[model samples]
Every structure is written in C-alpha cells, then in structure tokens.
Target: MRASASWAIRAVIAVTTVSVVAACGSGNDDGTSASPADGQKLSVVATTPEVADFVRNVGGDGVQVTQLIKPNVDPHEYEPTPADIQAIGTASVVVKNGVGMEKWLDQTIDAAGFDGTVVDTSQGVTLRKGDPDDEEMAEGDPHIWHNPLNAKIMAENIEKAFVAADSGRADTYRKNYRDYAAKLDALDAENTKKFDALPADQRKLVTNHDAFGYYIDRYRLEFVGSVIPSMDTSAELSASQLTDLVAKIKATGTKAIFSESSLPPKSAEAIAQQAGVKVVGGEDALYGDSLGTEGTPQGTYIGAEEHNTDTIVKALGG
Candidate 1:
C-alpha cells in the first residue's frame, strides 16, 4: 500500500510539471485571454497602409501590424468600422500619421477609451497650412510624407514608438529605423540636386489638389495652383475656379499638370488642355490618398518618392 501511494504521488508531480511547462510556452501565461504575445507577435495597429509599411520595416520580427485603411482608400474620409474599433482596442501600440490625417482616430479611440500608446508619426515635422483654395481644410495640411525629410522624421518617430512598446526589441527597431532614414536622406539629396538644376521659375507645380504643399515647401518649388478648390477630393471645383487656375498655370508657364492616381484624370486633362501644356500622368498620378498595390513601384514610400522624383525631374527638364 505504501509503495502504491508513493507511485501515485510521483505521477501527480509529473503531471503538474508538464502542465507548468505547457502554460509557460503556450503563450497565454497571463490571465488575459487575448493578450498579444500569445501569438509571439508585437500587436501593432496603424491608421494608414503607408504607416503600416513603415512599422513593418522597423518592427520586423515579433510584430504583427494591421492597417485601418486599405490601399486606394482616402484617409481624409475613412470611418471606423466595428471591426476596426475592436482591432484598435486590442492593439499593444497604435501608430498614426496624426496632424489630422486620420480624422477618425481621435473620436474612435475616445469612444473606445483605449489605453495603448498612440504614436503620431507626424510629430516634430512643421505642418504646412492649407491652401486658400482648400475649403475642406479647416486647419493645416496634414500630408507630410510627400517630403523625404518628413519621411525621415516619421521613421524616427516610429522607431521610438516601437522601442517604447517593446523594450526587449528596441535595438532591432533602432537599427531598422536608422537604415531606412539613411535611405531617405540619400533620396532627399538626389531630389535636391536634380531639382536644383531646374530654373527657379520652372520649378512650379500644378496639381489636382493642394496635396503637394509639403513637397513644394521642402523643395522650394512654387505651388502654382490646384485644379480642385479643396484638399478633400470629394468636393467639386467651380467653373470660375478652374478658369482662374488655368490662367494662373499659363501665367506661371507651368510645364505639367499633375493628377493623383486615385482621382479621375479627366479634370486634370481638361486643365492641361485649357492651359495648352502636357499632362504628366505616369509619374505625377502620384501616391497621396493611398499607396500603389504591393510589388508595384509606388507601393512603398521609397518607391513612391523615387517615382515622383523621376517624373518631376523629367517633366521639369532637369
């Protein structure tokens, strides 16, 4: 009887040990069932796909990112769905473009009462004001990524956010950010050199909207005018405004009328026809509202900037 009792005790100990080991390695040692690390991934959520790509570039291993906005969706008009709210609520870190770029985030998080670190990638960059023509812009223009310099700043901010969120992998985030920022710096230098070769007067740009303010401001190029009277493309331009913009383009001797890839090209085409100038579609149908489809040239931020630089330089005769 004593021998049998001892064997039973030993069997209980073995079961307990196995249970403990499984509990430690099975990813949910914590009481919270939906804890992020259970999947061995850093739970990250971003407002835009562009920001998601940036986070993936830096967060690397142990990170799973979800972009709130899909490709080709306008950030200006994105509304948070029930699924998006749940995603945001459960994320360990939420990265946003901020500067009013993700207009829905503020209210969504407020309503949900989320406590995760909200990283605004646009932090530290001086935001440009909206054009007088942009009626939808009640405040400043929030499209800072158009400038390579701002891209560098945003990459740094993402690095800091990732480090803060997961201190164990801080070094990985720092290295990735540094490497990407170096590439941005090189791109900036290349753009500056190429644009510098163009005559000051020839550096003027006309676009479908006022999305190019940051790009123009960074490069010291003149924003001659936009075809649309508002920053949000949902708004329509008046005939008087188009007539005035056409005259302004002619007056400035602008070389090209640049349109966005997502917007209807007819408006810009009409403007180009009225102004008697070339419509630079291929390169100038740029990534603004959303990036290109993955594996394409403008899919990534670096690729988009490169594509823009090549287009502008070619159009400007640099």
Candidate 2:
C-alpha cells in the first residue's frame, strides 16, 4: 500500500511539471501570453471608403485595414461609433483625407487615446478654396481625391507612412505604390483625352454639392452650381437660393443634374425639374463622397472615377 501511494504522488508531480512547461513555451520571454494577432500584420485604420481603398492598394498583404466610414455614408456629418474608436485605439496607423474633411476625427482620436502615426493624404496637393460664406468649408475643399493626380500624391504619402511604420516591408509598399500610381496616371490621361475631345460648352457640370471642385478643375469643366449651396450636405437650401440656382442652371444651359450616391437625390431632381433637365440618380449617380459597394465595379476608386466620367460624358452629349 505504501509503494502504490508513492507512485500515485510521483504521477501527479510529473503531469503538473509537463503542464507548466507547455504553458511557459506558449508565452514570450517577458512572460506575457501570445495573442492570435500578434506578429500577423500591421493593423491600419482608414477614415473613409476612398482612403481605405488607397491604403489597401498600397499596403496589399502587409496590412489589415479597418475602414471607419462605410461606402455611401456622408463623411461631412459622420459621427464615430464605439467600434471605430476601439479600432483606432488598437491601430498602428490611421490614414485620413485631411483638409477639413473629417470634422469628427480630432475628437475621435482623442477619445480613442491613439498615439499612432496619422497620415494626412492631402498634405502636398494644392487645395481649392471653399465657399467663404460656409464655415464648414471656410478653410478649403476636402475633395482632393477626385483628381487622379492628387490621388497619386495621396498614395505616395500613404506609401511613405507605411515604410516609416514597417521598414521591413518598404520594398513591397513602394512596388505597390508604383503599380497603382501608373494605373492612376493612365486613368487621368484617358479621362483628359475623353473630355478634351468634347466641346467646351458640353463640359459644364451641376452637381448635388460642391464635392467635385478638384475634378472640375482637373478636367477644365465649368461648374454651373450645386443643388446644396454649401459643401456640407447638412446645410439647408433657402427658397431664394434654390430659385437662383434654377435660374443659373437655365442660364448656363446645363445638360443634367448629377446627384451623389451619399446624398438624397430629391433636391437634385427638384432642381432638374425646375431647370428643365434630367436628374442622374440611382446607379448612375456620381460617387461624390464615397464609392459603391465592395466587389462592384464602382466600388473601387478607379472604377468610381470611370463611372463618373462615363455618366457625365453621356449626360452632356459628349
């Protein structure tokens, strides 16, 4: 009986020693347990759908990106959710389309306690002056990505940030940026050729809001006016302002009123009816503030720009 009890005690000690060894092997040298996501990839957070797309193109397999604002959501009035804050808190980098575009971002970052690298994609691009009357856009227009040239600059900025964060993947990020930048250049050239082929009068645009200033300036197109006078969608249109826009549309002989995917088309439709022009809505609406759903043609930055060009060209008799 004594011999049997001693064997039993030895067996218990052996099992406990093995369990402790296994647990120690599972942890790091510092004694903290390993997480599933540890050393997987660099975690990134993008503010908008467009910025997210840019980051994906640049980062490729090197990053796991969390897009804060989903497609078809208005960024001008977007409020961050708890999930967004959490993601920001854990991200190693946050890429934003700066220039007063993300009004809620500063406070959101503060709330998240994020001390990560923040990449403002609009750092080097020349900004278009916003409507002085509107406080939201008093500094400058934040729609710089509409022009593919500006997008190239933004992509370069993103690539630099990625390299700074993860120097080991610098070559991968640079190669990806070059490939995407070439594609952007090709798109820009193609659109410029297409628009240049049309008469100057056919290049006039009347959009839902002042979200395409860079695009208009890039293509040398005349901006008739926006249904919403202010760059912000939250601004209400006064009765006189609406009447004046209708008159301007009629006076300029605008071909069609292009509604935005992120905004309500009712105002554009009303204005178009008053001005005796068709309103481009539904699937044909321009992606002013966001892209289409993922996996669709219009879901990507290039695809959305191509769609916008085609829609505008067809509507304007080009």
Candidate 3:
C-alpha cells in the first residue's frame, strides 16, 4: 500500500509526459534514446512492480524502469486509462505477466499500436491450471513469478529482452541476470528449508482467492480451497460459495484463513470467524498481482517471497 499512492502520483507525471511526447518518440518510457552499447540508461516498462524490481536488479543503474501496476492493487481486473495508454505507447520495452492475467493490457497496447519490444515472463514456464482443464493456462501459467525458479526464468528473459532493446548493455544485463539468479536460488533453498519443517497436513491453506496456486504447488502444500473460486480477486463470493468454503475449512481443520492486503479481508475474516479459527497475522500480504510499498520487505520480488515464506511457515507450520 506504500508505493501504490506514490506510484499513482508518479504515473500521473509519467502519463502527462507521455501525452506531451507520445508522438515525438523521445526514447520510449525511460526518456533515454541512446543505444545499450552507448552506455545510456535504457528505458524500460514492466506491468508490475515485481517485474520492475527484477529489471532494476538486473538492469542495475544502466536501465531506467517504469512499472505499470502499483502495490496492493489487483492486477487481474485493473483497467488502463488514457494516460496509461500514452505510457504504453511511449514505452520502448514492455514486460508483462502475459498469461491472460492482465486482460486489459493486450487490448490496450494493441489498440494503441505501441510498437516496442514486448516480453511475456510467462514464456517457457509450464503453467499450472486453476481448473486443470481451464483453457486459461493451457500453455503455461502467467503467474511465473510465484516460484523462485520461475522467477529466475523471468530474470533470464528480462536479460534477453534488455539486450535486444539495448544491445550495448548486453554484458551488463547478462551479468545482472546471473547475479540475481544466484540470489533467487539461495532464497529458494532457504524457503525450501522453512517449508520443509511443516507437517504435510498442516500445510493446507484456505484463502480469499486462488492467488497462491504456484506457491502451494512449489512448496508441496495443499490448497484446500478459496473464499472466491476464481483467480480474479474482483469476483465476489456468494452465500452458497461461502458456506461451501467454510464447510471445507471445517472438514479439513484448516489452520488459517488467508487474505491478501489488496483484496478485502472481510470475507476471509468472516469465514475464519465462522470456522472458529484464529486469523493468521503477519503473513506479508501476498503480492498476488502487484508489489508492495517501496523499501518495505514486499517492495521487491525476493523481499515479497521472503515475507510470504516466513508468514506461511508460521501460519501453517505452527
């Protein structure tokens, strides 16, 4: 929630600048036109702060980055405005989650005819389907960043895209990717140890929505069910659905009813209260579709995951 309001203000500034220079092509979203080899900071745009954080880690000081989605906003149902369109149009490189997650982005970018490098982080990673047979993740799940391994893959792709966009910084991008990938590997190992301590049954989670499929899949935990069945947080839970979810929680003896900060906790809390379960606190608000406040633990992808892992281990393992 920290970066969201500030980011919105910055977005307004960026969008205003885009409106003035949309037709001029002043070096995409970053405001730099020099080629990557010329050592000029590359202008880059990513759909989410997580992506932007990855870019910053890999791009380092050599790249200028802009993130479209702010912290604590549900990206599943986010709508782009005229200013957003301008920002997209003016971007030289666009990195998006790309698994039909941001439904509005493709249409918006295509409609604007924004001709720039587009990188889909979901590329190449095998997707886990929510419904298993749901046509949405037939190719691969777009939520690739959910797992650290998948995040490493995203880092590699970001490197490739940065190289393509700015050939001069190819070496810088490659080194950055390698360093960041190593950091992610360490994080993965650490989280693996944390999650490994839990009894298998205690790992079950019933949540506000289907946001943690990848996290559950990665740690070998059971995703008992969701307060809302769909991947979209904007969807409301029905009375029947709430009753059913509560029934499941009671049946499974679910230890925690989880909620993301971006989404309403009322429904999940209601379910928790009904189930007579203690509401688990301190789980870093899961960055399902966005990042967190800058400088906070959830501000970056690694930081967000670290927050999530600590919270999950405590909530479920305890």
Candidate with better TM-score, 2 vs 3: 2
Look at candidate 2 and give me any clashing residue pairs.
none
Instruction: Give one digit per residue, the lDDT tens place, for model 2 in 130-219.
Output: 878777677799899999999999999999998877777889999999999999999999999989888998888999898999999999
Q: 1 or 2: which has the higher lDDT?
A: 2
Note the Cα lDDT for every prediction shown.
Answer: 0.74, 0.84, 0.74
lDDT tens per residue, model 3, 96-129: 8777776666656654446677888778777776
Model 1: weakest 10-residue lDDT segment is 19-28
Worst 10 residues of 2 by lDDT: 19-28
lDDT of 2 at 246: 93
TM-score preference between candidates 1 and 2, better one: 2
Would you estimate the TM-scores of all the predictions? Answer: 0.83, 0.87, 0.86
Order of candidate numbers by TM-score, starting with the best: 2, 3, 1
What is the TM-score (0 to 1) of candidate 2?
0.87
Question: What lDDT does candidate 1 reach at residue 153?
Answer: 86
Per-residue lDDT, model 3, residue 187, is 94
Using lDDT as the measure, the top candidate is: 2
Candidate 2: Cα lDDT at 20: 34
**What CA RMSD would you report for each candidate?**
14.2, 14.3, 5.4
> Quick one: how many clashes does candidate 2 have?
0
Q: How well does model 3 score by local distance difference test?
A: 0.74
